[model samples]
Target: MSSDFEGYEQDFAVLTAEITNKIARVPRLPPDEKKQMVANVEKQLEEAKELLEQMDLEVREIPPQSRGMYSNRMRSYKQEMGKLETDFKRSRIAYSDEVRNELLGDDGNSSENQLIKLREERAHLLDNTERLERSSRRLEAGYQIAVETEQIGQEMLENLSHDREKIQRARERLRETDANLGKSSRVLTGMLRR
Candidate 1:
């Protein structure tokens, strides 16, 4: 049972690690690092599925008495991993939408038109402090959204590091379990011989 859990942990670790590394390499990622993160996640997901297949084989090779426990663990792990990936993907989409809206401007106004209008308005308002203040507010609002988008991207990048740490810890745990299992198997064999 523990061994099966370890196998699932190992696969999760590997997939998460791949995604983390890919995210780390992205430069100045745009709005939630959505595009790059999505690409990396998709690739990792494929790899994870392959690893899961191998794990299934390993579980089948175990003694029948132990198979049920391991199989249950594997199923639970698959569900958890799937949920996490789906949530992460959803986050990316939400972030992308926020960024796109900010960059392209609201539905009623295109970015280009907004910019042109701002410039014209600013020019006309130059002689009037009140109008100038209004134009300035509009421009500032756009700038603020852009800044927020950039910040969100940075947060996503930081999340990759956290994800990598989690995976590394999981990998370490799996390796420890593998070593212990090997030792126990040897001990059992020796006792049987005696």
Candidate 2:
């Protein structure tokens, strides 16, 4: 195996172990910390995915005779990644359930609990609506910027076209001047000969 391949393998090992440790720690963390840890783990998982792709590409570049062992290792790594992702998801679900239970309490079916749930839902909807409105405004701003950029580009192209036409006219004048110079030289030669 190439040194680069070995390096990537080592990096992947360390990353996966780190992710696994983070996932395990999520259960013990406070709600805010758990959220942050989960986000970090998710990002690490994406990095792991990229490393796996790099390893797979590296394996493909090796000789066919040597490929079988690397291929097996790749399969094992993929299975490990799958298990890690599943564990991460399970941890997230467990955390969510814990939060939900804490919020709903033992009398989850009571009228009071139902009213609380309704208010929470309403607030969540309001937050979503505000986020959507903000997103729409941002999209409008982006569209306006794009339109202005296109107009600027069009004006630049027009300026270039005008410059090209001016150059062409200058070249035409130069040719006419050369022709007149040649005619003047011939007339002078004829007069000298006479």
Candidate 3:
């Protein structure tokens, strides 16, 4: 392996070990933490896969030689790299499946299942909120009706007061006329006696 490959190999080793450790601890981790850990491991697995592919590309890029010795070494390197590639691909697939399982727990703990449940809960809450809003609107309407009724009652009382005042003035005018007629009749009687 070239010097460049050494770095990738080290990275692949570290990432693989990290992914293994994290995946092993997933079941023990709390749901909140476990979800994040699983996501991180998934990214790590992807990085590992990339490193493996890079290593394969580097092996293929080795320059050809006219001599059979270099050609033989290249063939041997290709065969070994092919086996490593297969192993890495298998591991990558397995890790990807594990990520899916972790996020979508098999037994009701799946993030996907929880998302649906939470959405339903949110919809139910919104329905209750709409009901409350409608009830408040009805309450407001009832209050407006009560206020209008009160205003009507006040107007009726004011009109009745005006009518009563007019009747009282009419009674006063009739009494004054009756007194005037009595005075005039007395004057006429005196005049007749004369």
Please report the candidate that would top lDDT against the real structure.
2
Task: Quote the lDDT for 2 in model 3.
Answer: 64
Clashing pairs in 1: none
Instruction: Write down the lDDT of every candidate, Cα atoms only.
Output: 0.61, 0.76, 0.58
lDDT of 2 by residue, 1-194 (tens): 57878798899889977887776666557789988998999999999999999999999999995565567667767867886797788668756865776686645468557756654564464445445544654675566557657667887999999999999999999999999999999999999999
Query: TM-scores of the models, in the given order?
Result: 0.42, 0.53, 0.40
Candidate number that wins on TM-score, 1 or 3: 1
* Count: clashes, candidate 2: 0
Clashing pairs in 2: none
Better of 1 and 3 by lDDT: 1
Best by TM-score: 2
Q: Model 2 — which ten-residue stretch has the worst lDDT? A: 125-134
lDDT (Cα, tens digit) per residue for candidate 1, span 59-79: 888888546556665665465
The residue ranges of model 3 lying beyond 4 angstroms of the native Cα positions read 1-109
Cα lDDT of candidate 3 equals: 0.58
